[model samples]
Target chain A: MALELLKERWSSAINVLKVGAVKEEGGTRASAITVGGQTTLPFLLDEGGMPHRPVVAMEIFDVAPLEWPVSLLEPFGDAVKDPVKWAKKCINEFKADLICLTLKGTHPEAENISADKAVELVKNMLKEISTPLIIIGSGDKEKDNDVLARCSQATKGENCLFGLAAQDNFKTLVASCMADDHCIIADSPIDINIAKQVNILITDMGFKPEKIAMHPSTAALGYGMEYVYSIMERSRLAAFVGDKMLAMPFIIFVGQEAWKVKEAAANVADEPGWGDERMRGPLWEAATAVAMLHAGADILVMRHPEAVATVKRSIDSMMKGNND
Target chain B: MLVIGELINGMYQNVEQAIKTKNRSIIHKLAKEQLEAGADMLDINAGPHGADPKETMRWLIETIREVTPAPLAIDSTKLDVVELGLKLAGEGSMINSTKADDEKLDIYVPLAKKYKAKLIGLTMDKKGVPRDKNVKCELAAKILAKCMEMDLPLEDVYIDPIVLPVNVAQAQCAELLDVLREFKLISDPPPQTVVGLSNVSQGTKQRSLINRTYLVMAVASGLSGAIVDPLDKELMDAMITAELLLNKNIYCDSYIDAYRKR
Candidate 1:
């Protein structure tokens, strides 16, 4: 008969997945980052436990340059040419929680670089940075299958997070991650069914479900970002209520989606309605990353340091009452 | 869970008024709400409203069909009323009930076969519900046998062990689980099991708690369908969690959301 007495009893808790490795664990990272062990919705420590905070991973391209919008490139400066330095700068300067080494050059159409080149870059970045590593392959399906597999093997014992595996191209990457004791990023189109099916398929391949991270294809804020938000939200809700298949930590390509959108890079001169170009781009990225985080993104792959700092502060302060 | 939404019945003021006034909008609105809340089927009952039961069934069917062609469970003790609703309903339907009496099964089985409608056979016979699990199972097998003899596929038969109000029949609660499990062994292609879930908490203070707890336990006992209120958020949440624990559904973080989307 009373409102306060109406407390609900949630039956199942989300399964937690720990990514990254440390020295004792046979890797060089400063610490392991664990996510997805929430007993309630994000930061609802009132309802249940949120074992891990949303982590921010500063993305560094292996090849760099050529295509980054000036607003984005302005922050990194000379570090653009070398990945090892770029990754180191993200950790040492921005205090990035993790380093996501994007093997952009390995895409067949981009530089047509060989898998050997990507492996070398991964090794160098791992050596240069103390933060946990998350390696992302270029979007090309066939090329990513080869590049991610080889890179996964090259850093075999590091317990890194490596993937971007689609429904058709997951086997090689899944096998590599399974064999190497690394985590996976099971990427699906912006659809729940496909996202769930992909996770099932990856697990069906004998890979443990907890070692997977979801990349339910997202879009930037102005460019249909709500679809990504809903998909991720749904995935998390399912996980909280006891769906182990979709219970993996979510890894959103915030930087990738945010930077590619026209609004993030559009110049004020081109569209006078948009105020300053410098502030617009980073703010756009920050806004998108923040949205993804609240929508149950466990790890964010972000670009701008200012945006990274903003999102990190947002994550830190968001869990204020939870006693994280 | 085959949620047969308990709305769209004349028992509620809105639906009673809708049935009396033939207000298609109100019936359609409830139908949509139930479906949105993840009901697999809608139960069309011309509850205590002031109208001819047959005409009320026809009107309810027309109102529901106007918006969506969702499956319906024609709920009424009157066989003719259920038959009329089943005839007017656009798609598949489940006859809300028939007791395990041979006379009732003889009539209901032929009607079910002729209309291709599924039947919900209660495990209570002329003597009323027996508290014993074997007694309940025997009645269920009697109904299952009649359906088999009539060549009505066993899959189309859903056996309800007739849940008793826990406040009075608390002793029957444990036997309910035993009866459900034994029903699976009654026939090959095993008749699906169902329950009028809310009946378990008929006069109980913790109605929602009792309904969901009993539903989850019944699910563990292989209950395939339940006549439940789709709008009961906590009840639905508990059922979703139960399926996940049973490993019937692949686990997802947003399981309730994903289940709702489905």
Candidate 2:
């Protein structure tokens, strides 16, 4: 008897979306990042094609972080005091594929930075680095609607990927992206149906389906990571099985979720048996990111340079197909 | 659930008059309304009154295609009329039905294969509707066997156990539901099950209530598709809720609105 192999072919594929634009395309970035365009499960090369490998976007905040632990902040040094230097280090030394700048200062509870100030910071960051950018607003819904819209206009031709478009507050951001020719990140809390509904709502507002990426929400490695993993797996399965509305590529904030968890944030004295705080912290973030890649994350927004390097190696190995 | 819109048939006075007078507006309006109401596919039928049923089907298909690219179900009992519709309907369309009889299967199965359309096999023959669940299952088994022999994919084959009106044949309604459950066990990849949902409420006073209840019951029994009036908002709501309960769709406060938009 001969050995038999079973392979399932899918009827549809994830829409391929390109983020950023170069000088010739009316953008200041050196190159655009392409994601999605997979017709099968992640790294199942024998069954179907995964044309673009998953990329990493290192996170930097517009305002200096007041809460980041010393272990996590040690690598960046004085760059942590300035957003432009932090973004430049992420692109030049950390070798990040893209820069994810969060406008935390614009939140009402924070510095309450004006939209004009946020736009000036974005312009300075763009001038400092040629890497594609992923700009997200502060968590406040009302504040984000105002700040993100202004940032979106300032970077009109840059074609940056904007973020956190929720079901209720997507209209302003969607209109901005439509006018400025940029991609969007749709946010959904761990529910597959809500993820789909958010995408539908954005598309209904005339946003092209191909240009939208999904953030199905994320969790730390030991803190309900399985929930985020399962939701993403189910979502990818739905896409492969021809659900057009659920077929956008996934964007996960591995660093934001992982670093907040105590396992990654606790000091060595707090838990002696868990190994060194510095090693455990970055490893925890890296592990969460790698796990997300297996669950079909097209782009991972991570913190910590060490964790980013570790995840980049994993992505390289996974992109080598089944030969290894 | 696959909601096949059943409003385009010439059996309806408006549709019949439109077909006789070649009024594209009425047919076009029905087609658009059914689709907007969340019909996965439209069922096209030329009733007995049309002198040239083939011509009527062509016109109906052409009129619908001009408006939307949604898939059509070429529905008719006549083989020639169905063949004509299939030829003009393009791909992703379905043959409304063929019987469980071998002679009908021998012709209709190949016709379906040739046209690359799905086949709906009714689990009844010259003996008419089966009297019990066991007999219906046997007929369904026969249809599955024929589909396998003809190399027609079972996934594309829909087995209808035939619904009986509640006002007349009340006892058979339960029997029909049982037959739908049994149909799943007939093959490794079971054939999809569908029913003309309106049949269960024929001549009943609370037609809408009976039809909605029976449709939900049928869905619980693994009925994958149905031919119903999509324009009935309450009926569509009940069907959507049934699917949500089955965990086919995730629950949200505006799940009904989300489903409609999808």
Candidate 3:
């Protein structure tokens, strides 16, 4: 039997975004980070060029988490309460590429912190860390609109990545990002159509496409990971075939979703086979991140320092000989 | 889809008047309106109303140039008028057409190379408008062969399988779509395909309805561009919705506006 070689050709490519603008480019940071611009599937080094490596962003909170699993809480120790110190630990100790400062305290059901308080906390975090910031607000639509707008104003020209501009509550956040010249995260609930629609709506307002990232909601391994997997795959495929709306770099909320799954951190006192919850949680998070990387995730928001390290090691290894 | 707006052609009453009087305002207004209505390029034909089409084409090019930098389609059967339009319209101008036959291609095909302009090649030959898919496909292949021999890039070449009037050539309508689908197989990197879209609806009472429905069918068959009226709102909407359904454009709730923006 004779084997004939046939190569697949792609008409379009995903757009690369240089997210955090440094001082020379009008932002205060010393460095900028670029993501996306993959012509082929992720880590398929032989297929095409992956111009930028996938970077890890460790999620920090404006207020301390009261319900974090014991496995997650043990690492931060006392630094969890203060946002600045928490951001510093992600950068200084854990070597996170970016810090995603989520204002979880501003949720109406939670602490219900005012916009000013959230802004103030952000200002403090900015003063403390030089790693690029991805500022996200509480999931509550009304509260996020009020809080994120103020936060955007405080970080004007800093070129921070602000996000979760969902379908129902995008206007205020989009306006804030536009006015401040910051990047936006277009979020959808694991649906490609919704993801594409949100992107189009934002771009229709004259928002630059490169100043956007996609957040197709993620689920952890052994917990509907297939849904997240396929959505991301379809999104990247569409982008490769020249769908501009879905071409932005993907930002998977790895830490939040992966940790939330029972397989990652569930206390297994009843089942002897579920052994060693400590190692299991972070390992689950890492495995989930690795699979997502293969499925075209461009940014990973992760917790569990060990999990972050494991993901980082894998990225470094995969990215080592990527020249085609 | 590449929309070459048809409104600027002097066959229209307003354009005819603009050509005769050399009234830059009337011509510029038409050019600006068509551009705003989402035309990628404007077809500047001085029509039968012009005493000297070459002078009229030059006038239109000069007037439109003052307002916008959108590319112009140098539309004329006369080589001199087409050449003058190209001269004034500059680098990105498109030759509105040439037939597959040697008599037309000998002149117009080289003009595309000389000026580095995009060329549109018609499927009809000396025998006249193609009667069926076989003739259309055969003519397209002949044009592709000519383009190759002349060292012309197929990427810049557009194959136009002429759209006949539905009221007359009803039997040929379905076959035209088949020709459009088969055009890609003529070359590895297929030449782009466009059609004179309104011709499909000529003499029909439901002109807009037939034109749009046929345009969508053409689009589904891999037609890449068309010379049509951008100002036709329903027609433009149908084209955009078809593109979205065909996955040519990304989906958005406000996709119509977004498609225009893109």
Candidate 4:
């Protein structure tokens, strides 16, 4: 008797989203990246098609970090002090596919920079690095509305991806992205229904579905990571089963979530049983990224040079259909 | 669940008056309201309204198509009326039904295939509705076999295991649910299952309550579609909750709102 492989066919495919546009297409990036468009579940090529491999976006802040551990701050050296140097080092040395510029300095409790200052930093970052940018606002909702609108206008035609548009605060981001020809990140708090609802609300505001990405908020390893993993799995399954509202590509913040956990951030002397802090931290981040990739993450906003290399290699191997 | 809005049928007095006067506004309003309430398809029936059934069907379809392109179920007992509606409504329409008999299948099966329309097969013959669950399954198997022999894709076939009013045939209600469960076993990729949901509550005082409770139970028994009044908010909410509980949809606090939007 011959072996008969059972294959499940899906009725729909995930929508493909382009992150950036090159100069000929009215953007200054050297090249653009396309993600999503998977006809099957992640890395299961025997059943269907996964046309594009998942890409990594390295995270940078507009202002220097005051809380990063020694293991994390050591890799960037003095580049951490300057956003342009940090972005260039990420693209030139670490080969990051994208740069996620978080405007944390604009928060009221932080440096409390004005929208003008945020726009200046964005302009400087765009001038230095030809890589695509993912610009996000500070956590302050009222301040983000003002700062992101200014930044979005300053980066018109660049087609950068903007972030953190939740259910309650998506109108401003939607209008900005609509006017600027950029993509948006629709965030939900680990609930698949809210995830879909946020997408619906954004689309209702006339933002094109192809220009939207879903951010089901991330969780680190051993700290409710499975919740996020399962949510992404269920979401991808829903998209494959022809739920148009949930059919957008997923963009997860692996570095931001993973690095905040004690397993990845605690000092080695504090927990002797857990190996060295340097190796343990990067491995924790790398494991989280790989797990998310398997759960159908199309774009991972990651940090740590070593973790980025590991995840990139893993994506290459997975795309090659290697089972070993 | 594939909710087929049951408001456009001439059996309703309002629809009968609309069909009699050729009132496009009345029919158009019903179509829009049902769709807005989340009907995946519309069921158009020209009941005994003393008008030319073919003309009434054509007028209903044309009026509704002007408002929206939602799929229509060309519902009628007359073969000529069904054939005319099928021709005018174009592809993606459904034959509201045919009895599980060779004579009826021979005509409806070919017409459905030629028109690229779905065919709904009721599990009953000229002898009348089956009293036992096994007999209903036997009739369903006959319908499935006929569809297979005639080269129609089973995916386009919906097996309706005839629901009777609880006031008249109370014993058959449970049996019909069993038949729905058994219908899946008759084929590899089972044919879709549907029910005329309002039939179960005829002459009942608590019509909405009965209809919704029975709908949830039928959904649990693998009912894939229902012909119901989508405007009934409570009934539609029950259907949405049942699907969510079955893991057919992901849960959020505002799932009812989400389903209506979808």
User: Model 3, which residues run further than 4 Å from truth?
Assistant: A1-27, A37-51, A114-116, A204-208, A240-242, A267-275, A320-324, B49-52, B83-93, B106-116, B130-133, B149-151, B178-192
Best by lDDT: 4
Docking quality of model 4: it rates as acceptable
Model 4, range A273-314, lDDT digits (tens) per residue?
Answer: 998999999999999999999989999999899999999999
Provide TM-scores for the models.
0.60, 0.92, 0.88, 0.88
Clashing pairs in 2: none
Model 1, position B44, has a per-residue lDDT of 82
Instruction: State residue A116's C-alpha deviation in candidate 3, in Å.
Output: 4.1
> Which number leads on DockQ?
3
Tens digit of per-residue lDDT, candidate 1, span B128-240: 88887888888888898898889988878899998889998888888899888888888776779888898899988999999999999999999999999888999999998
Clashes of each: 18, 0, 0, 0
User: On DockQ, who's better, 1 or 3?
Assistant: 3
TM-score of chain A of each: 0.94, 0.98, 0.96, 0.99
TM-score for the first chain in candidate 3 comes to 0.96
Give the alpha-carbon lDDT of every model.
0.84, 0.90, 0.87, 0.92
| Model 2 lDDT per residue over B144-163, tens place | 88888989888888888888
**How well is each residue in B55-145 modelled by candidate 3, as lDDT tens digits?**
7887788889999999999889888998888888889789988999987887887889999899999988878885767778889999888
TM-score of chain B of each: 0.95, 0.98, 0.96, 0.98
